[model samples]
Target: MSSPRGGTARTAPPGRNPAPQPAPPPGPNPEPDSTGLVPYPAEVAARYRAAGLWRGHSLPAELMAAARAHGDRTALITPEVRWSYAELSATAERFAAGLLARTRLRPGDAVMFQMGNVAETVVTYLGCLLAGIRPVCTLPQHGTREVAVLARHLGARGLVLQADFGRGQLPEQARALLAEGVIEEAVVVRGEVFGKAVGYGELLRAGTGNDPGTLPYHSRPPEGVAVFQLSGGTTGLPKIAPRQHEEYAYNGALWGRTLGWGEGTVVLYPLPIMHNAGVSLALQPALLSGAALVLAPSADIGTLLDLIERTRPQVLPLVPPALAIRLLEEPRSHRTDLSCLTDFIVGGQKLPLEVAERLRDELGIAVRQKFGMAEGMFLLTPSGAGEWIRHHTVGTPLSPLDEIRILRPGTEDEVPDGEIGELCVRGPYTIRGYYRAERHNASAFTLDGFYRTGDLARRHRLGGAPCYSIDGRIKDVINRGVEKIHADEVEDLVMRHPDVAHVALVAMPDPVLGERACAYLVMEPGRAPLTVATLGAFLLGEGLARYKLPERVESVDALPLSNVGKVSKKELRQDIETKLAAETV
Candidate 1:
């Protein structure tokens, strides 16, 4: 869900860690501004620049470099189209010029994007970067509430959406947002023309720039905001994190080197391109490394498997456990020739170690567990770290310049190295502040400038390198009056059970205790229902405290996932409340 930017308990803004940088330099905006574009402190910015971390390079500049270095190389492959490095570079420029020529969109104005894994999203995202437009990446699953809040808050200049998504929801939401003066224009892809909707393809063709490669607007500032990604997971109101160009570029290239990315690396992306993980961890890295990015038509297991068999990509980034389960059970997965794939980068939510083991042992591939956030922190198991590090932890921070602290909850004091505490971090890649939400920033970051990541973590050694183990988010705890039970700790225990296929422990409201633990389970076919007493005994035997035990047990065929593929505790909590309300009636 959301890392409460302020203090709702559900929060994790983005990624961070390394040695603590010197006290935030005071050169940048001396204080937070109302526009919500929080600039890094002056001293901090100067330090990074001196350290050679904040190079004056933007994403469009990187694309131009890629085109120059590997002009004839295949750069992008989607079911509908394929483009080489030169072509991709030219297309990005064309799309940029087209936006300038056709749309009322001005430089620095925000363009809201709601699309799937299709190539159009990628094209538009890069085009926005090149055109000096900030791409606010809203998920395809976001509904009216998220759209309205984001558009209105960000003052989005345009809405770029997929015609095929949300039945008729996005278009209606776009119209409403426009009516409320939240958006100025709407651009639809592969859908019917309605109102002032402009066709995506038509927009790209409207370009007539003779030399589109030249960096317009004085080469675009390296520290300029590149895009807006939803902070944390898909569980709460969408909070936009304005990622800067130079720092964002560094992390993407760092990931390539960390994962041993090279010219031959072929990436298959199945997640929404508008997501932080997709753009930062996959798309940008792939392009910079001279790799080909193959965009799957959809996240469907069978469809992805067919694409993998045909494409034989070297790296497959991001595998959610549910999709892993589906992949394991799917008949095509057994026969699919995925031998070329060397690493399966798993993230979105904390992936159980067992899933990694299965990916390697069962499927004969490597697993790189990653912990990435929209606000700019990225941790992934490196390519040559071996399986021990990959299986034991989510690996080290992508940037050595990233600093991390395992602080006791709600405090800046560091805990014992091996003990669990809130993971607070700040780095070159992580956002200094959220866009336009000044009230939330006060509680979101510490006085020293570290972001208080609401996830529980402990530092551990994997070989000689330092790595951290995530102990679930602080918001995932089930509060029983004075006592708190970590949902993941209980879910981990339940997941070990022979009959349980998947389990999610969430807090259920209780009149006296305020909240109690409820275990939502997905079991193997024909398994008997799990009783609260049975789970309690199992947890007790496993040495969990009595207060930590589940008080209610519910079973479903599958746990509902958010639009971004996170286990939707919001829905589970709602279900529990609904059941309780019905019981009272």
Candidate 2:
């Protein structure tokens, strides 16, 4: 945990900082709201869960059932093309048969697929299901380096990859890995074919006339792993989180119900389908509930908005940072025909309370915050709630088979209600441990059983509903020795300054003290008076602890953001460390 990427460990600001410590943690019994929905205890949550209407089944079975029910209905719609359920099912069946004919990839055999957001990606994923091949979905950024690491660790037999991803050539890198005996076979999708690398078209041809009915091989048990999603790779190398068939299917159904999606709903999946939110909110829900999925890459925001206008989707799932910044910069006139949008589901990153308010007040759209990770455990603010809670709270826990506990970080003791603690969860869908990393798993999980979410949250009642509010990340929180300052709180305070367009709070190296908060700011084009002292005064006036106040402020043209539109704190922290080192010299 000591500066993962080679930067000095951060510490509190140097000075006799006088700020009152946080109030004593609240006791278990909090007053309920007038509607009897707020401060809902475990008993009340149990009542809501007691309906016993949860859908727990195998993913393949659910896919087949949907295809049978809506044979000709449009299932997946891309900008360039449209695919009917029948057509997709047929194609997947053929592709699965082709995989079988080409390689000895049988049930339980892991195959790594490095793909982007495209139609072929979906087909490949479905094909894996039909063949009972465990598909490990990876980002386009992953080349031989990542693929080889994961392939060797997972004992992968095959690699399905896009020909060109960004600047990397899949054929060349894949060939290197193959030569090194990392991966046995390679199935290249998109563009030209190569020696030993079978093109998608050629492979599918072998499976032509394949019976769609016999597809989605059922040799593996329902509880067996179906998909392998990599962890955030925060602690040096990444770890694979395997998802089971039955629980994965159940997650989709539960998510569909939470979103209030039915057969007529059309979801816009602009992000990569490999992501949990993209799959759960858009693809899985659409497929399981017989709704239509609109696929588009999120790289081009304008194009995505255009697609939204054309498709008239009912639900739009978006990560907060990108859309929030867009809505702030772009005029209302640019948002075309969003009247069809019922709710804009935001997740993956911190959703500023200000952004939520603006969307609700200006666009007249509901901003529902959802919190989840790839390993599983989806907690959503129940859909169609009052505007206040939907905008602020991340909703209640949705999974019927899930259990949640907020324990003091570095300790097994559970914190009292209304107190921030590390969120730990265990459930049918949530992975018990990381794949092939006994050491990592031993560190990540509890003695009994629970995947530490690494997120700091507090139980809260908002708009008469019981839910958890994300304070910030344990890793990202600036530890000021005597007190811990959550970056989100600091960001929220600094964002209130009209001159500041966006802000990121990162820990900078300190001499005597361990670390001090360094503010990286993006200001309005003509805005001025952005200095270290000015920002420090603003935080002090806002009642932030002196240690919590930014000791240094670096004004920039714009904040560095990740591909997903979140302020890349990881990158920002690095930048600050570099600056600190240079200044020290």
| Top lDDT model | 1
RMSD of each: 5.0, 10.7
lDDT digits (tens) for residues 1-585 of candidate 1: 111221111111133222333434322233556566888876677778776667777766875676679888888999988888888777778888888877798888888888888877877888888888888888877776777677777778898888777575777777887787878888887677678778777777787554674536337888778788887543344467888888888778767766677777889988777788888878998888788899986788888987888788888788776777777767767777778888887777777766667677777877778887888887776667776777767776766567677888988678876799998877778888888767778778887677888889888754465678788998888779999888878887887787888888889999999999989999878999889988788888888888888899998999998766678898999999999999999
Off by over 4 Å in 1: 1-30, 166-168, 213-218, 232-238, 386-388
Using all chains and alpha carbons, the TM-scores for the candidates as numbered come to 0.92, 0.87
- True-structure RMSD for candidate 2: 10.7
Q: How many residue pairs of model 1 clash at the backbone?
A: 18
Lowest lDDT sum, 10 consecutive residues, model 2, at: 1-10
- Against the true structure, candidate 2 reaches a TM-score of 0.87
Q: lDDT per model, in order?
A: 0.77, 0.72
- TM-score, model 1 to reference: 0.92
